[model samples]
Target: MNAVAVIEAAVPASPREEWLNRGKNLGAERRDVDWRLADWLSEGKAAGHLDQAGFDFLADNLGIGPAKLKLIHKAAAIPTHLRDTSLTVEHHAHVAELPVQEQIELLTEAKRQHWSDDDLRKQTITRKVETGRAAMLSQEEWDDLSRMQFLHVWNRASVAAREDIAELVSQSHMRCIDA
Candidate 1:
């Protein structure tokens, strides 16, 4: 007599777990060492032991660009407890470049949304662009830039003359204020 055997399948892993597994499959060991190096660099920087030459040497020896080393140093500024190890060093580096409060908010959102490193980088870039634009442009300057861009496009379109485009732009501004 043959008896049938019942086997239970394993539960599926969460996104974080899946990501961790993927990283484990990759060169996680090397990454761990990199993280440690970042920490060491941070400590040295804090103690004023690491100078420009030291940074340059590390960057050269590591075979990474100076910009990447700078990012690693910025990432190391994040406190150990607050750091989200689930994210890659690059993600931390991007977030660390932001203000402390913004860094926390972005990291929290990234973890909650299970964002990829690229997603985090994109969001960081967008925020930086917005911040820079706001700082560099007054409302009048921004409006001028917008109008210039609109005029450039309208000039190429035979359907709308300069006067018509100007009228439409004014109407759009009025509509925005009304809303």
Candidate 2:
């Protein structure tokens, strides 16, 4: 449920972190969301994967802060054609054909690549299912996602000493010493 079931509560960005909120300065400009992120979400919807609640969670937690996120809550609640299971995407396919696992896989890969959902859907519609075959995701996408090299490993490590940290990032904003 990336964009279908949820609307995140965005907090406003402060001076130092303002760059990530899409827009924070010059007024009016801030209301618009990042188009690419929105697109990824829309694709998630078309694929029958994105729900409103999940999308809200991601936007609130990762993409924007609380105050600003909350501001867009109402606008994000609007329903779209993709939300109905009875309706076919592009006007075809049974409701059963839209597999949840496939949708989830598609969303995950798109997130990994930072792709808008619409981009993925267009690719699917124009290429994957258009070649006179049964409806299915592109084989290239499936193979790419399934490959071992595509795997990403994440683990946390511990560290000590503030000075050590500053030394490590001496050239960064977190630098301890005022060089």
Candidate 3:
């Protein structure tokens, strides 16, 4: 009897390291959201790119009472950085002048693991994906979750994707993740 053969490819280090290091030095959220939520939001607010209505729309989806919404609106608007899955706590730390090799480590690992943009987006939107280092969450976890739920309304995924969640199956168990 002959045994079946399989061919697998190996991933390199240079490109992955480069990607994890790239996309930095682009934010300036040190004043507002950078300290609280994200660097992009701080810059957005400071630059006058973030509008109150956009925040109002985001706040409306929060399901908080009208009174609380007013308070949030008065305090700070939703940071545009939250919109990107790649944005993480390290981004804020970078703005505040903090060292975060863990951030790099986690990102490198995620890249090596080949987590797709959707996978990273799922983690960000679900508040499950955080910077490798722990300090403070960028935004209200509920807010992120709620925003994801709201966006799902107009967004349509493939049948396979719909099953990706509802199927209650683990790819690792089927030689996906662990492989």
Question: Using lDDT as the measure, which candidate wins?
Answer: 1
lDDT of 3 by residue, 35-137 (tens): 3533444556678866767456645775444434333332233234322234433322322211234334434544566665445434543433344332333
User: For model 3, what is the error of residue 31's alpha carbon versus the real structure, in angstroms, after optimal superposition?
Assistant: 26
lDDT by candidate, in order shown: 0.74, 0.42, 0.44
Clashes of each: 0, 27, 0
Candidate 2 Cα errors over 4 Å, as ranges: 1-16, 19-97, 126-179
* Candidate 2 C-alpha lDDT tens digits along 1-179: 46667779999768668664434343223222332344455566678765657666767668664333332332232234233222112111111134445444544455466554445544444343445433364464455434422232111223445445446666676545444
Best by TM-score: 1
C-alpha-based local distance difference test score of model 2: 0.42
Instruction: Give me the runs in candidate 3 sitting further than 4 Å from their true place.
Output: 1-43, 55-99, 121-179
Quote each prediction's TM-score: 0.53, 0.25, 0.25
When sorted by lDDT, best at the front, the candidate numbers are: 1, 3, 2
- Candidate 1, position 4, lDDT: 96
* Residue 146, candidate 1: alpha-carbon lDDT: 68
